[model samples]
Target: MNKIFLFISFALISITTQAQEIKWMSFNEAVKAQKKNKKPIFIDVYTAWCGPCKILDKKTFSNPETAKFINDNYNAVKFDAEGNEEIVFNKMTYKNPGYKPERKNSRNAMHEFTGFLKIQGYPSMVVINNKGQIQKTIVGFKTSEELKKEL
Candidate 1:
């Protein structure tokens, strides 16, 4: 009977831990959501080949406390800096016209939106206010504690 109780308790704990994931959305979806409910936008701009970007995802964004705070206060977006997706912002359409599909997993053309934002490095965390204006841009990998303080 004690063994069964322990198993049930562990199962519940696992379920609760898995439920703390941050709700991530695309940039366009975040923008549209802001029309109904205004919230600051947190954009994680990363490239596939960036080592620090992967570390940031595993260490910082995956933290349960960090995920909860971001979900409660911001619309989080995961954007590929070199992706070919078309982005519409501030009455302009941005695209990666020079993006080569063959080089997708490696270094490729930068998205026009990335140039518009003037991002200088991978794993950049861009904070946009509820008014759709940039608040801050933090470059490189940050621990969960460090990222929480910034937010």
Candidate 2:
């Protein structure tokens, strides 16, 4: 009976921890969720070849405390700045015109959405209000504590 009780307790703890994780969504999904929850959107714009972007993902975003805070407050989005995906935001369609298979791993031309946001560097973090307007843009890498403060 004690063993069974311990197992059940462990299972519940695992579920609770997973629930606190940041649920990363696409830009469109985040926008859709915003309509229902009325929460701001957090976008992390990165490229495949960026070193700081990897650090941000591994060190900052991996922190449970930071993830929980973002999960509770904002709809998170991971945007590939040079990706060839089609994104529709604010009644406009954004695409990558110069995307090629040869440059898929390296830096290709910027996507229309990246230009629309005026992102000048890799690992740019953007905050969009619930009203679908951009609130702020912070470029470069930040620690978990720094990112929490930004949020």
Candidate 3:
């Protein structure tokens, strides 16, 4: 009985520890949510080949306080800088017709939205207001504390 109790305790502890997560949505969903709630949008633009992007995902975005703050305050979106996903924002349909699967890990063509935003580098963080206007852009990796200030 004692062994079973210990196992259940450990399982509960693991579940609680894993609950801290950033709720990332698609850009379209974020736009719809913004229309209803008037919350700002936070976009994390990253390519798969960027090392600093991975670090930001693992360290800053995964932090409990950071996740909770973003979840509560902003409509978060994770955008692949080189991906082929279609995004419609501000009466524009953004697509990457030249995206090649072979160049998934290497330097591929940028998504139309990325180009539209004039993102010069990977790991760019964009803050957009509820009115669909760009607020600020932070290029490169930032710690959780730094991101909190941006929030």
Candidate 4:
């Protein structure tokens, strides 16, 4: 019983860690990692209820080719456009205290990153250079090959 339990625990931990490798990370970590790897950072700005976001995660993000390419070339960050999380950029604080959930054009309307990247649609992907400058923002779904060309 003890051996079986240990095996199961290890299996669960492996699965959890595996999922983390595929998902996007935050800004600070991306910055630090870019210094070492010299690859661009990719940010996926999405919304909770965005259907296209789900599709991209499943169809584009989950692909083995996509995984290899992203892991090799970019530090991916996933940010929700409608979220109220406070983000600091270049010594400036971007927050929407009046951001009401599920509302159309409220006081806390959009995240600065979203506006900076000009994300017109959910699942929008923006590539930032090693110096943290905006490279380009790719909107909508992309096949593995389609995305590979951009990198």
Tens-place lDDT per residue, model 3, 11-30, is: 99987676678889998899
After superposing candidate 4, which stretches have Cα over 4 Å from the reference? 1-23, 101-108
lDDT, model 3, position 65: 91
Cα deviation of 148, candidate 1, in Å: 0.9
Candidate 2 clashes between residue pairs 3 or more apart in a chain or in different chains: none
- Which whole-number lDDT from 0 to 100 does residue 129 have in model 1? 85
Off by over 4 Å in 1: 1-15
lDDT of 2 by residue, 64-146 (tens): 89888899999999999999888998899999998887998987888999999999898999999987889999899999888
Return the candidate ranking by TM-score, descending: 2, 1, 3, 4
lDDT of 1 by residue, 83-128 (tens): 9888888799999999999999999999999988889998899998
Candidate 3's error at 111, in angstroms? 0.5
Worst 10 residues of 2 by lDDT: 16-25
Worst 10 residues of 4 by lDDT: 104-113
The per-prediction CA RMSD against the true structure, in angstroms, equals: 2.5, 2.0, 2.0, 3.8
Lowest-sum lDDT 10-residue window in model 1: 14-23
Question: Global CA lDDT of candidate 1, please?
Answer: 0.90
